[model samples]
Target: MCDKNCSFDLSKRHLLKLSAGAVAFAAVGGLPSVSYAASLTKEERDAMTPDQVIKSLLDGNQRFIKGEGVEHDYLAQQRTSQQGQYPSAVILSCIDSRAPAEIVLDAGIGELFNSRVAGNVSNSDILGSMEFATAVAGAKVIMVMGHTKCGAVQGAIANVEMGNLTSLLDKIKSAVGKTKFDGERTPENYAFVDAVAKTNVQLTLDEIRKNSETIRDLETKGTIKLVGVMYDISNGKVELL
Candidate 1:
């Protein structure tokens, strides 16, 4: 054990072992801990401005497009949000299951107040909901999201009528007339349909501003922003208008 060569080899081995342990510790430390929790708390929501809320949605959409959406613990979020919810935005979207606003935007529970209807059209009831979500609940942004290849747009293009759906589609008819498209102007023309859909979203925004004094006042005072977006079902992309 006292031989010079043997002593040197032993010291080298011990140094190597120590280095390996250090490397392992560093690797473990680099990993995100299981106990690490990230949720949109009331304070966090309250700290964000209307523009910041819109930027968050846009950034989330980019993550969604990249297939890198945030991993959320739904049960934990539910338990934590039980005390109260401080959502930042209210989204008016179509009833189509393919274009869920929360999923496309990569938003968590208690992050947005969602209002769904056949064509994402604003009526008296929807306007009232928007006012409550913004003026009462402190939502900072109002998003009217439409989708390409929407069945409601197609129905409006073809004038399809069935019970309550007839009245609902009637609201979208004005958009069809207002959309300036040189195409065939039929349900068969998808470009025309999508154009009309976009027009529908704009019309809804106009209706919201015209119908709800509370929402308009909030927007006028810089407390909230009204925006329109189109979600493409083909590629899962959201384009702001």
Candidate 2:
């Protein structure tokens, strides 16, 4: 080897320039370079299969559980979805701050059309919203999620009451009555509270299936799938129901 001794040899520099030029040439010709989306739009994500869609959501939840959540592009996403949204999932979850749909599911913009209320009940307005999500907006899946140690569920178990909150708590009473725990019916009984939570999610899912004609038709046609989930606040694993 000739001793160029850490100096930039002209021929070697020229070859380096040639290599870079060839790389630029190939990139310009689009020879399998990455096609990144600066932001996801409704039309851009249109080609995903059903299994792919579910896997995407599950991956996001994995990230969330590990606290490796991605940075937000919410304003950019809001602008992109201003025209329309083809959300992949319709989520019915509790309104607990810790159980926010995006954070819990680790979904990005335009991923889920979320509908949350106490007990995740399927009232008329919620059913209407879900109908729109599945029928009008073309969501692929509907998830009804209940959380552990839910205050509403506890209130229902003990018959707790307030002015307007009474009615809200009353909605959950059905779950309490439905839950057949051999022990006491007090909030102190963790088993009782947990049972009611699961029962409420199941009951809410049943109500959605029975009441919403749009969802029923979609389910019958195999156009959409409905499932229930339970979020454990202590340990972030979402148990699929």
Residue-level lDDT tens digits of model 1 in 91-209: 99999999999989887777789999989998998888888888888888999999999999999989998999999999999999999988698899999999999999999999999
Model 2: per-residue Cα lDDT over 1-241, one tens digit each: 1121322211111121233434334434523332222234444334333444455566567768889665656776677667776677789898988788778776656668898887777789999998988888777678888999988898888888888878888878888888888988799887789899999998888888999888999988967778888888888878776
Q: Count the backbone clashes (under 3 Å) in each candidate.
A: 0, 0
Q: Pairs clashing in candidate 1?
A: none
* Cα lDDT listed for each candidate: 0.78, 0.71
- True-structure lDDT of candidate 2: 0.71
Candidate 1: regions farther than 4 A off? 1-39
Q: Candidate 2: where is the Cα deviation over 4 Å? A: 1-39, 43-45, 49-51
Per-residue lDDT of 8 in model 1:
17
Measured by TM-score, how close is model 1 to the native structure? 0.84
Pairs that clash in candidate 2: none
Q: Pick by TM-score: which candidate is best?
A: 1
